[model samples]
Target: MTLGHSTRLIAVAFALAGPFGLASQPSWAEPTQGWKSYIERDYQAAEKHWRTDVARGNPNGAFGLAILAERAGDAKGATEWYEKAALGGVPSAQVLTGQRYAEGVGVERNPVRAYAWFARAMAAGVPNAEKLRDRLAATMTPSQIKEADALAETLAKP
Candidate 1:
């Protein structure tokens, strides 16, 4: 009878603990962990964990990968991952993509497209997007600025 009670208690404990343990493990935890490592400049570990998260289709992982690639001086890889993250709707990625396009970092310079993305990031309330937008506007000709504004307006619509 004592063994039966103990078995029941153990089963109950397992039942209660199992779901909590699983729930405590978030989908983003690994990617966040990788980001922590990246912030600490542990490039190898950051790449490893971030790659694991990327394999699971996490946009944050792609952002981390982009940062890591940039740190490693792999422009192509950084651009690709930044594109992936931006298309995934990561706001910071949108900002970085706009900056890249504006400067012709990995892709050709396209002020209209850069303005569109900066506008998107601005609408998304990323803190410094407006500053970048203003800076890009300053570098553009009146005609180019008009074109960029038009593109940004169109992109702002639902």
Candidate 2:
């Protein structure tokens, strides 16, 4: 039985490795290449690859594409992609979307929405979010602050 189990494990490993071996590059290499293109300022190439990855449900790819859109001056596209990434649980995207809401960049300014997003990012452990949350708190009335805090607490719940 032990020998049979070991053989079965080895077979599964070989099956997984087969596709990787046959390809000149591993399947996961595309996302890395896409990120490198982004870092090198090749926005079009990065967008192409990242869009493909995003279509396949890659959260990092969605975040990268959103950031590229923002840097490329496509505010509408950036907002859409950033929202998608944030919904997909990318903390940086949540923080950026919140900042945009706070500053009235791309979208209309809405302090409540901004605070909610910052709170989400803070809950996710984005260290800078806490500072932003405090700053946002300073701009609100007591009731508004209480509302925002309640919203944040609700979002923090699993």
By lDDT, the best candidate is: 1
All candidates: TM-score:
0.66, 0.71
Model 1 regions lying over 4 Å from their true place: 1-31, 138-158
Q: What is the TM-score of candidate 2?
A: 0.71
Write model 2 residue lDDT over 1-158, tens digit each, in one string. 25443234324322423322111223444435676776576778888888887787666577677667666677877777766766666666677777778988888888987898788877776667888888998998888877877776665232
Off by over 4 Å in 2: 1-31, 150-158
TM-score of candidate 1 relative to the true fold:
0.66
User: Each model's C-alpha lDDT?
Assistant: 0.68, 0.67
Against the true structure, what is every candidate's RMSD? Answer: 15.9, 15.1
